[model samples]
Target: MVGFLGTYQVSLDEKGRLNVPAKFKGLMDKQYDNPNLVVAVMPDKEGRKDREYLIAFPQEEWLVNEEKLSHLSGLDGDDRNKMREIYAQASECEVKSGKILIAQHQRERAGLKKEVTLVGMSKTFEIWATDRFEI
Candidate 1:
């Protein structure tokens, strides 16, 4: 699968299914097959619960991240625990028919009701509520 790298707006239906943009789907075809994606809800560090969002990463990329974290040494125990917590909270999901499911908590935390913006960062994608973003 191609690395995540762009942004697109998508509509979130009542059931929480949202389309991954066509371009992103095209990009997926180039880099992966039977693409299994992972989703994680990350809250802002500054105590803004409403500022949380979901992050999706291609399985391969996630594995790389996992490896990097696994190899961490000489780090404080608290920092390592935090990383473990993040990884444990992530969910493994599949991209089907160009769409993915955002968990209810993830939707609510991000204030995603009817619409969402899917942004592709270098190695992962971020889900932001339409209202949380400025066009």
Candidate 2:
């Protein structure tokens, strides 16, 4: 697969649904087999440039990451705790009417109000609070 490049500025509706960019949606339809996508909360860590955001990826790709995380969790104590923390903060949803529903808790974690900033990474996309992104 190629990269999920570019940055998109969008908003969530009253129902907490944000539209996926057309190009990214096309990538999902054409390249990914999974209909559902997983939204995982990425917390801000010390020395990290990026702020707290949500990471969204197709189910299949997420599963691959999940498998690797599972393996790492088994061999290390610190990684095990981190893995559980990340998994616990994740939520799964599919694109409907061009939008993906961000779970309430996940939305709250990112302080995602109506306005949001969606950034496309190579393997996954990130959703950020509009104000937070500016900071």
Candidate 3:
């Protein structure tokens, strides 16, 4: 892997599209070229509304995870229910011109409007709303 691996603050445009940090682009090129990537809007407890964060996973990786979930489907009962919840939130997105369009609901969920933070997470990357991560 390339040495350019970490997180950085980025800006989101009026259309909710975020630019990929240059360093991150190098890493992405080295790791993945798949046009399709999955951006998931996640929310945690405290009703914090995960609008500040966007989870990016390559479509291939998502598929691998999907396969794992598929295996769990065979298991009857509670396990299946849990996986169902996870699947319900997963969404597929395409990375074009190094930008990904964030869904409106996801933006609202994460409280992301304008500014965003791009975090590089080794295999994938994350986009966080500035307000939610003010330091």
Candidate 4:
């Protein structure tokens, strides 16, 4: 399956638009079967030292994740709430003029300032703060 496979240093503008790495763009154009991407505020399960971040995935890849989430023990109220949160917090983003406009709330949730670290994670990628990403 098509997937991302590199680490890149990127940046976000004051308007919350991020400059996706060129390599990633090429992969999307040549290998991705999806029409768009989704950027979401992933829960910081690790609870890192104040370093919040978001995650991005090609539509096809995200569908796989969504499918898994749908099957998670939704019998409990907490599980249901978590599933609702993930779906509610995700945003559909398009590459416009070489950048993706991350919604203001999404940007804030990720604690992204001017600098960002976009790390490829197979089917998806993680957006981290410059310092938090640790290169």
Off by over 4 Å in 3: 2-4, 45-52, 74-81
Ranking by TM-score: 2, 4, 1, 3
Predictions in order: lDDT: 0.77, 0.85, 0.70, 0.81
For candidate 4, give the lDDT.
Answer: 0.81
User: Using lDDT as the measure, what is the rank order of every candidate, best first?
Assistant: 2, 4, 1, 3
TM agreement with the true structure for every prediction: 0.82, 0.89, 0.77, 0.87
Give the TM-score (vs. native) of candidate 3.
0.77
Per-candidate clash tally: 2, 0, 6, 0
Candidate 1, residue 16: the lDDT equals 91
Stretches of candidate 4 exceeding 4 Å from the true structure: 46-49, 73-75
lDDT of 3 by residue, 105-134 (tens): 777767787777776666677767777764
lDDT of 1 by residue, 1-135 (tens): 356777787899878998888777776667766476888878788868777788888787778787877776537887687687577568877788988887776677678888788888866889888677653
| 44-121 per-residue lDDT for model 2 (tens digits) | 887342467899988888988988786774568788778877889998898886789999988888889989998888
lDDT of 2 at 40: 96
